[model samples]
Target: MRVGRALPLAAAGVVALALALTGCTGTGSHADAPSPTQTAWTEAPTDSPAPTPGATAFVSSGTAAQNQPVFDAAIRKVLAKNAEADGNAVVAALKAAGFPMNATQVSQSTTSANLKPGSIMVGVKVGDSCLVGQWGAAVDGYQSTVAPVLGSGGCLIGGIPVVG
Candidate 1:
């Protein structure tokens, strides 16, 4: 009789320990669980449109694509007002307009010629697609393509031009 009682108590203790270790006691919601590896690219809100096909390979979305034009126009307006704006200013303007900071990359010109009135490129990653805008002394335009999340260079169609 004593052994039987001890066995049931020991079994109960083990079950309790298992439950405690597994966090199954209703202490937290499923959202509290650890998530898999996520890059900055995966952080967009759930409702946005899926990344368009071939956006990473430097292929144009063609003339009918509206987002690129709108983004380009916005950036152009800012640059028109202040040609000396740098990468940080462009990025700040973009973020204020609700662009996700995690999914955006901004590169500024390093040489004196590319400085104020130089060049700045801003790339926003959507899924595997990228929307890039460039403005400065040497370039002014936008391109929609497939690009790395942390994009570099001018994203110019023919590569960054030699700017003096």
Candidate 2:
């Protein structure tokens, strides 16, 4: 019968497929094989210079005008570490500078075209005011500002929150 004939052919095809798959197992490294070539520390280095004692302390209970300098200094210091840092890095720098995460906002690093943007905004809400700044990419070393919080109660018009 045609069904009976097809069964053996199908079984042979399965066996052939199994044998073919066995070749992929050989892709694993063997102890006898040479190790990968030495890799230089190519990526951005994580280790940063020690912060100067009492450097640019954040004014926790101060108004946005009182804290804008601290916020600006914090971003500049981090950018000194990595000039091409993303929006998250800028936010992290502000966080490390004692800005609360929930009060922060950072814009997307890349545009909708999947290309690096001219600059990305970073902000930290201090009381009723917001500390907002733009940096990176085509930016020529930016200056941050202190402004009233937007109608959305955020410094940025459209951006992800720092806590997010």
Candidate 3:
């Protein structure tokens, strides 16, 4: 079942448990049993995976429509919230500045990233090892579109030009 459907049942189970506990007054049946205590578990140590670097292609096995909002929101929120980033916001600014992307497609890859400010990078990949330049090219294309809207000598966050 979908998570939306399962949540209600899960909530009902919690409510039922609370009602059952509220009505219970005696707890003498298990008094003779061993003291209730949990044993601490120690996991066997193993080699840890290396940390993921900047933007990398992550092929999705799911629908892009479902994942697009999350990806777009993340990019938008980051650019909007940060004073140093302006890529995605530039796209929006360009649209507001009278230049809209004619053809745009954003795909989510399985790859994850933890990029520092001013060091963000994205990659388009083919298979496990083949990296594509489409992502970079697209950024440049969008930058060109936004540049005119921003005019000359304006600072940009990502692709969005920041005026004053």
Candidate 4:
């Protein structure tokens, strides 16, 4: 009789263990629901102002010579992970999107951390040739900006760090 009782208790314990392992399906650990007040844009704004056609006349805080190496290294990393042409692609995309940027003429700053470790910024000529810079945040093992260049994978155009 004791053996029979022991068998039922063991079976109950196993069932409990299985339920605990599976966890509750509702409100699961990985669930990420956006708040209701947020509105997702279905399309880009048609009335938005067009981008500028050429590079702008803006003075960065630092000089190109001082920060070239850091910029080059950042570009290399971006390209290596992004099909070895992510830098060019990013520049092309910016041009296509009305922010004409020169990827080949990479520059850096001196006397400041314009391209810093945790953040990076890529400059673009916005409307009427005004300079508009797009910044990037370090994501996982990569640096990604909000607006990617042409032929690049995503909207993150550049990862060149700001050294100031």
Candidate of highest lDDT: 2
Query: Compared with the true structure, what per-residue lDDT tens digits does model 4 show for residues 61-147?
Result: 322322233333444444556632333454544434333244222223211654343333354422222222323334333342223
The 10 consecutive residues of candidate 1 with the worst lDDT sum are 56-65
In candidate 2, the residue pairs with backbone N, CA or C atoms under 3 Å apart (3 or more residues apart, or in different chains) clash, namely none
lDDT of 2 by residue, 1-164 (tens): 99999999999999999999998779766988887885642332234232344457666666666677778788888788987788888777787778888888889988899998988888888877888888865668776877778999888989788774
Off by over 4 Å in 4: 1-42, 45-78, 81-99, 102-116, 123-138, 143-164
Predicted candidate 2, C-alpha RMSD: 16.9
Candidates arranged by TM-score, highest first: 2, 1, 4, 3
Off by over 4 Å in 3: 1-61, 86-164
Would you list the C-alpha lDDT of every candidate in the order shown?
A: 0.55, 0.78, 0.34, 0.38
Off by over 4 Å in 2: 1-55
Best by TM-score: 2
After superposition on all CA atoms, how large is the RMSD of candidate 3? 19.6
Q: Which runs in model 1 stand beyond 4 Å of their true positions?
A: 1-66, 112-118, 140-164
Every model's TM-score: 0.43, 0.62, 0.20, 0.22
lDDT of 4: 0.38
Span of ten consecutive residues with least summed lDDT in model 3 = 141-150
94: Cα error in model 2, Å: 1.1
Candidate 3 per-residue lDDT over residues 21-121, each given as its tens digit? 97796667776779967554333123422113332222233222222333333444445565345344434433342221332222232224743332323
Residue 141 in model 4: lDDT: 36
lDDT (10s digit) by residue, model 1, range 38-150 = 67445444454433542322112322132454455556667777776776766666665555566566664565564354556777654445667766656553333444433
